[model samples]
Target chain A: MESHYFPIVYLFGNENLAVNLSNILMITVSMAIVFFVCFFMARKISMYPTGAQNALEYLVQFIKNIISSNMDWKQGKHFVMLGLTIILYVFVANMAGIPFELATQDHVVWWKSPTSDPILTISLAIMVIVLTHVYGIKMRGLKEYGKDYFRPAPFLAPFKVLEDLANTLTLGMRLFGNVYAKEVLMLMLVALGTSSLMWGIFAFLPTIIWQAFGVFIGSLQAFIFCMLTMVYMAHKVSADH
Target chain B: MSIFAIPYVRMNDKEANPLIQEFTWLDAIYQLAAFAVLLLLLKKFAFGPIMGMMEKREKHIADQISSAEKNREETEKQLAEQRRLIEEARREAKEIVENSRKMSSQQADEVLASAKQEAERIKETALAEIYQEKTQAINALREQVSTLSVLVASKIIEKEMDEKEQEKLIQETLKEVGEEL
Candidate 1:
């Protein structure tokens, strides 16, 4: 894969950092889309919602259900905003590359799903994991939160630490892998179509089918991401967990 | 060539590792910042107002329902009161009818008794009147009888002796008695 990099050198000339400009641009675009959709839906609210407002409320309710199912409302209420943000942002990011991927002839990708990149997805996962820890300490107090690690046996503490690392890796990689695979398959199909007329005809049907399936995968992945986020949050915050 | 080209870095296509190329702290930092901003804006503008509006609507609906229930109860109470009043009036009218009927029947009985008493008194007066008239006619007849007897005796004494003369006197006396009667 090709990328657009912007390098930043340390003032001491000790190290260099490369920023992926494509990811930045795509991430910003996705955020803007999510924000505008929410803004318009919430613009002229009424007692009885209709059209966009109805859809928006349904989304809110859907996130609320996900939160409530994992934990009680008192603990879950704080997470509704976080849940909405994740679901909307990840979903928009996942769907952004589907219709068409923007790239040069040399395969220099300028625009695609930001979530297809591991860095972005893992960043989101890290943020969520960090928030859960923050909330756990805030709600349960640090001593109680630390005691939660030793719950069935004091010997389980090491494995518990490993589990948090594993959880972060899987949560982030799951979204990245699915979206990346879909994009790769799409690119392959496009290449096959360009190779020959006969192949083009064959590739056309598969591409359309894959795009439709891609939509389902995108939406499902978004929901799964949110569900796991709340479940992880519940584990950290809830007394029973 | 672009405004974002100032920090341009040469491509490292030969690295042959997609994961190594994609992972960057700068991208992560930018994504985190962007996501945080989005969360803050959405919470303030969208979620807060909508949830508040929903709660208000729910309260309004509850108030309306309670007020409606109160109105229905009041109307029902009024209906019951009206029915009671109508029932009382009906009972009063019936009582008035009953009293008038009793009074009229009593008046009828008194009139009948007075009329019967008048008839009896009139019958007694008629009987007394008939008796008095009969007594007056009898007394007048008695006086005429006495006078006629006295006149006849005197004529017989005034003319006595010879047979032919006595017979002529007797005839004259008879004619005079008849004329006097």
Candidate 2:
């Protein structure tokens, strides 16, 4: 297997590092792309939306709908920016792997999906959850926020605490797992087909089909991630709900 | 060590599989910073201006609709006033026609009454004149008859009485005769 083509170690360092620099590079590039798209869309906003403005309006309204549905718009409006950032960043990061990766002279994979890295997903998850807690405390005060854990029954406080941990874990792991598996499957298919000429031609159909399915899954996961983040925030920020 | 050594130091070969990477603080910082920057930029350029434009357009439309409604109401009110004026004029015209008809009829009645009175006065003057002429003619005839009677008496008596006695006798005879006629 040519799996060694992906660098597992730092190209220059002797110290123990788990993350590859190339993964970070790809994530940075994906972020840049997301920034560019947003900047461009925002350049010519008008009272009457046309073409790209229409699409931008749709995206903005979509995020607004997700927020307003969960809680009062006054409270939920703050989360729109966070939600947009997550959806756009995750989508772009997820799509990074769709194109064939460029190989370096030292056999390091140049561009792979950033969401495939557990580090990025975990970071995003932690960030989202942390923000919810921060906003919850800010909106409800510390005493009120603390009282939320003992609701329904006082005995369930431990489980409630565990729920927070579990929510973050699942949120991060779900995205990481799906995106990683997609890349692994593609890698396996490519590896399987390229070994033999007849297998390569036959494998083309499955790879092409999986790639199309991957695009759908990628977008769906991004949407789900954003929606869940908003739902969790809404649960914490809302006084009664 | 330089500030850049942190990423490399964090990137270790202990987990040689790049696919399975440990969570590092730097990556979290980067992601958070990247997101923060994105949020700031988008909030400034995209959501702020777009929502404002939408609100502006909404307000403008509302204003236009309200103004149109006001104009329509004004036109309706003006039309009502005009109709009222027209109705008033029509009513006044009818009254004027009725008054003229009443005045002409009164004048005709007055003129007819005056003509009848004038004809009656003229007929009365003519009747008075005819009665005066008849009375004058009768008186003249009476005088002539007296004179003729006297002459006849003188011829028949043939101066039988004296002058004084004759005057007295003539008066008596004239009186008697006048009475008999």
Candidate 3:
């Protein structure tokens, strides 16, 4: 049997019943950090924005541009809050594990990228899918919204349902897979550094180079994740989709 | 052998670590709750007010531009009205000057005519008074000459002839003298 050294769980006790408590703690802390930064930036709004306020306005306009590009502002304006939340949360979560990681007394990792797990990403995907349905139903009456499932023929309803499931699954799994792979590769590089004396000669340079590349990949993943969420939402809300 | 070695697409048996096996429902619930809380906080504090401020600023700029245009229009109207008033005042002043000039000229002509009439009346009165005085003086001189001739005749008759003849001559002479005068 193959064996691995890393513990997915940071710590375990009778008091903790939640699955993978380490990831949960990381997620909670990341959420709190995101909320505090957002609150501080959003504290003072003015007619003429300056400094931090200007940065905040820039973000608002950027999100507005994204929404308007995909669909009309009339229909897309309602999703601004969701877009901001997703982009900020995902970006922060992506880079959270990059700086430095901590280890617990039990030799398990206490800090890592929360998005690397399937549970959190899948939950987010499900929430997005459910919200799209809610918005579709609200915008188009029940009779009209239900008509999309039977388009082109009545026998294709099951396929359309399958399509929805596939879309959600892929959306969640894409993030989880990419982040998990990045973690594995970084771990391999670290292992290469410590495993052999000859390997140590080239290990430090490649590890540093890979870390920089990881930063780029992390940012790209956050952008793609947010972009896909908006696109999926557009399909549900807009008539052209 | 594979397309870019995608993670989920490939069956990597070595990755079947015990810790990465199963997904729990509780974590999903927790994630949902966490996201929901995030959405609520951001919606309340961040997105709503920021967007509102933007709209408000846009409206304020539009209002300022329109009001400035209105003020310019009002100033132009007032300027036109003032120009008209000034033109009217100038016209009135010219009319007043022209009327006064006409009145003064007419008054001078009247004064010249009245002075000419007064001089003619004075000359005519002096001529009438001089004729009247000449007539009175001639009548008085004639009466004195007749009286003197009668006295001389009476003296000569008393010295040379009778009284009746002398009286007849004096009457006839007095008659002739009166006719001639």
TM-score against native, each model: 0.76, 0.79, 0.72
How many pairs in model 3 have backbone atoms within 3 A of each other, for residues 3 or more apart or on separate chains, i.e. clashes? Answer: 0
lDDT of 2 by residue, A55-126 (tens): 877787899998988888989888877888889889988888875656665555667887887877987899
Q: Best by lDDT, which number?
A: 1
In terms of lDDT, which candidate is stronger, 1 or 2?
A: 1
Please provide, for model 1 over A1-241, each residue's C-alpha lDDT reduced to its tens digit, 9 standing for 90 to 100: 3343323222222234556767888989999999988998899999988787778888888999999999999999889889999999999999999999887655567788999999889889999999999999999999999999998899999999999999999999999999999988888887788799999999999999999999999999999999999999999999995
Measured by DockQ, the strongest candidate is: 2
Candidates' C-alpha lDDT = 0.83, 0.79, 0.75
Off by over 4 Å in 2: A4-19, B1-18, B72-76, B79-83, B100-181
Docking class of 1: acceptable
Higher-DockQ candidate among 1 and 3? 1
* Better by DockQ, candidate 3 or 2: 2
Q: What would the per-residue lDDT of candidate 3 be over residues A1-241, giving only the tens digit for each residue?
A: 1233233221132223335555667778888888888788878878888776777778878777778878878888888888888877877887787765565554456687888778788888888888888998888768778988888789999999998898899988988887777776777787787789878877989888878877888888877777787887887788766
Q: Give the higher-TM-score candidate: 1 or 2.
A: 2
> Per-prediction count of colliding residue pairs?
0, 3, 0
Report the candidate with higher DockQ, 1 versus 2: 2
| Residue A4 error, candidate 1, Å | 9.5
TM-score of chain A of 1: 0.94
